[model samples]
Target: MSEHLFSALRRWPDIEAPNLFAVDASDRLILDEAESQLADIQPGELVIMGDNYGALTLGAAALHGCTGIRVFQDSLVGELALASNAGDLADRYRTHTLDRALLADARLVLLQLPRSLAELDEWAQAIARFAAPDVTVIAGGRIKHMTLAMNEVLVRSFDVVNVGRARQKSRTLTAMGARRSLERPRYPATSVLREPEIPVVELAVSAHGGAFAGATLDIGTRFLLTFLPEMKSDAASAIDLGSGTGVLAASLALARPDLHVVAIDQSTAAVASTRETANANGVGARIDAFREDALTERPTASADLIVCNPPFHSGATVHAAVALRMLADARRVLKPGGELWVVFNTYLGYRDYLNRTVGPTRQAGRNSKFTVAVSVRA
Candidate 1:
């Protein structure tokens, strides 16, 4: 059953690389294992979270005849994949954000483990607070990703926790005895980075659990910010594509009052954090933080400048497809002569692609680890 569904899956619109695959051994193991452990769960009782593509959600609905399954994914790409692949089973499941309504009364939750301990903690906390007292939670991921710290995180939310034996380099962790639900959810933690060591000082960074580097100044972003003074000064508008916590957007607005910045991220938590970071930094009025897929809705040649520190990975796989797509889309959104300022790992060789897709590319700055480039839109 698992093999049948796995073979039918595709990671459309997502980068298809030889090193990256839509389905994996872990996905197969999780579904089969969850089905056996949750054999008696009612159709609506099973909930799926963090499924890459539609494996967990579609598998349960299509193969197990489960109905009314609720699912939540942080990536906009992942959400679209599940919808596109729903086929005739679309009616059996629904997609949601990490919300109280989704988790309320859910008894059996199947999950793909997140890399961030904070993200895992956030999920565990939500399930503990929103799920039924009798709820049983089973989370799975690649063996390399599983850590003793994960078990420790779940123990805070559940009284009963067990780690399953590894199968095909994958494993699942089970939990029960949920801690009492919270009266309200408070997450996407905030931290204030204040130091004379960095140019962007006293900036309050807030990140939703999935946001990269969790509100801290990632080295790549910090490296890019070094070239902020060179950005178009007379520009009326700017965009920060794939803006995680609105770090670049907020910084731009605060640095230049004349520039109205739009910080776009696909994650709801990221949108909230961007707004929070903006508000905290007294630049919220100048920044419009949006939860969106790339800049698909923006008009062509709409911007004076854009900035990005694109992620090279989609989920667990290391690949450049996401960056390539973002760059291509960035070119569509930039006005002729408008520049897309990007800082990436020095080894990625993104300069060649930028020249082909966006326009003439020039290295704005480079350090030991990162290369910042300016790509003008043709």
Candidate 2:
């Protein structure tokens, strides 16, 4: 039954990756490890966090007939995939965020180990604070991605952090024994990165654990900023697609006072981070930050210019479908003769995609690792 569930699953968006092959070896290992406790895990007491695409949740439910399962996935895409995969019409599994509602009395938690120590720390903290006193957390990740630091993070929130045997190049961390909850959570780390060219200007960036780069200036973004002066914003409506912390939006708003900037990202954490950064940079009035699925809902021909440093990685796999999707959306929302300025890895071969999707494309800047190009919407 569990194998059927895994085979039937599909990743939403069906991008460059295979939808039929959504479940990975790590997922199989996590499910195999969790199934041993199926008889002990009571219905409605099992919570799954960060299930990439409903593999753990649906597999558990279908395998053990577990109902009322609570699930928390940070990605909207993943959440949608869960509903679609389960044919969820009733409240078979309820969707929740990282909170007491998700963890309330949860006796068994199956989590996909995050790459960042800070993210794992926040998850462990929340699980400890709200889950049952005797809750067991089985967190699994690929062997190559697992590190000793993850155990260190879990140990801070739990009394015991035990490593499980590696199976099929995957390993699980068994965390038990809860500790006293901290008075305040450690997420949304805040810092200030001042513009060197304009010493008087600074951006206060606040990043939740899941945010990309965590309130730091990425090299691609830093390179993209140099071309901001080259843009003519007489049309006054500019968008920063895939805006991580609204750095580009804030910088553009500060440099071009006449322009109204909108920063959009798919991650909820990114939306919050971008809003905080814009407000702290004193351009809140001119900059609006919102969570969106790649400008799909934006009005056609509404924007004059769009800037983006599209992520080559969507979920765990490295692919160009996401960047292509973003470029297509940017083209749709840009007015005739409008332009899209996008930065990508030089080897991703995105320049040709941009040229065909938009109009004529020109190279604006380049380094060994990244390329910044401008494309006019036909």
Candidate 3:
């Protein structure tokens, strides 16, 4: 039944391609490693983080008849996909933010180790600070993505970090014996931007653990900002699509005090990070940050300007579908003749897609690594 259930899982509402998958070997390995511990756990005591889809949560329920599960997924798409795939078992689990309420007294945790070490540290600290003193964390990832540093991060919070045998190029780390003297986790890390490339004198960026380019400006975004002066001057509204740390959104609000900016991303941390960044930059009133799968919830032909340093990867898979979707959606949401400015890796060659999806695209700027383009909505 577990095999059948895993096989039937789908990555809907997310980019579904032949190479991308809903569940991976790591998900299976984590469940396999936690089988004995799962049997010893009670309903509601089992917590699952970074489940990707419904694999860990539904797997626990289907395999062990566990109920009252508490689950936290960083991505809004992941949450929605889980709901879509959950079917009759949807009532068995509840979604939450990464807080004491989600980790409090959790006896057994199933985690899909995030690629970001900062994010791993945040999760480890939270588990240590709020979960049961004897809670065991069954965390797994692909061997290629996992590092000894991840175990070290867990060790900061857990006294004992046990390495599980590798299976199918995936491994699990069993972390137990939460440290008693844990300090308050410093998440949503804050930093000031003073780089010469950034037009803003001191743009403040606040980022949660999972936000991309946490609390700092990425080079791609920096390149994109160079063309900010050329953006639609008469525009009253703008969107920072896939806004990471709200750098673009905050910058837009600061540059044009009259403009209302909307920052959108799928990650819960990114949305909160964007809001924090806006407030830090004194543009909170002008910037509205929210979580959505791209601009799916946004009304059609509503915005006058949109700026995006679109992500080229979708959950570790280097694919163009995610960026293409964002571009297409930006077109759908832009009023006639509105501008869509984007920065991407030069190697990705997204201009053709921009021309096909958005409108007539033009090269706005380019460096060796990145290219900036502007597309007028047709």
Candidate 4:
């Protein structure tokens, strides 16, 4: 039954392509590893983290009759996909942000190991700080993405870390004996950016573990910032689509104190980071951070300008669909004659695509690796 359910799950509201999948071997292996625990736990004791879709949560409910499960997914799209995939099992699980509420009294946790060590540390610390004394965490990931450091990170919060045998190129780590006396969470890492090239004198960037680039400015965003002076000067409202760490949003707000800026990203971590970054920069009042799939919540033709540094990859798979979807949303949300400015790797050749998708496009700026383009909505 679990196999059939996993097979039927879909990654909708996310980029669904041949290479991208809702469930993977890691999800299967994690479930297999936690089968005994799942059977032993009562309703509401099972907590799932990093479920790509509904596979882990729905599979547990279907196979073990577990209900009232608390689940936390970093991406808004992942949460929506889980709801969309949870046909009759929808009421079995509830969603929560990663906090004490999600982990409180959880005796069994099934985690899909994230690629970032900082993320793993944050999860480990949270489980140790909030979960039941006897909680058992079963974390799994593809062997290629897993590292010895993951086990090391778990060891800091758990007295024991056991490595399971690899199956189907995936492996699980069993962590037991949570150390509730451990140090406080070291997340929402903060940094001060003093780059002379930045529009603002100094920008405060804050990020939780899972936010992309984590409290640091990625080069793509740095290149995109160079063209800010050329953006629509009289625009009253702007959106930082795919905003990571709220650097662009905060920078824009600081540069233009009167302009209202919105920071949107699918990741819960990114939204939190953006809010923290904005607040730290003293622009939180002017910036609104939301966990959204692109601009799905914004009305059509509402935004005056949209700035994006679109991602080229969906999860670990490099695909064009992710960026294309963002571009389409930007086109839809911008008012007539409004501008959409974007920075992307030069090799992707987005000039012609932007021309066809948004409007007549022009090269705003370019370096060897990145190209910034501006498209006026027609």
Q: Give lDDT: candidate 2, residue 353.
A: 81
Poorly placed runs, candidate 2 (over 4 Å): 14-20, 88-90, 197-200
Predict model 3's lDDT versus the native.
Answer: 0.89
TM-score of each: 0.95, 0.93, 0.98, 0.98
- Backbone collisions counted per model: 1, 0, 0, 0
RMSD of 1: 1.8
Clashing pairs in 2: none
Residue-by-residue lDDT tens digits, candidate 3, 311-338: 8777766788878877778788999999
* Tens-digit lDDT string for candidate 4 (241-346): 9998999998888889889998899998899999999989899999998888888899998889999999997666678778988788677899998999999999
Global lDDT scores for all candidate models: 0.85, 0.83, 0.89, 0.90
**Candidate that scores best on lDDT:** 4
The reply for model 3, stretches above 4 Å from the true place, is: none
- Model 2 TM-score, all chains together: 0.93
Q: Extract clashing residue pairs from model 3.
A: none
Q: List the residue pairs that clash in candidate 4.
A: none
Least accurate 10 contiguous residues by lDDT in model 2: 13-22
Give the worst 10-residue stretch by lDDT in candidate 3: 179-188
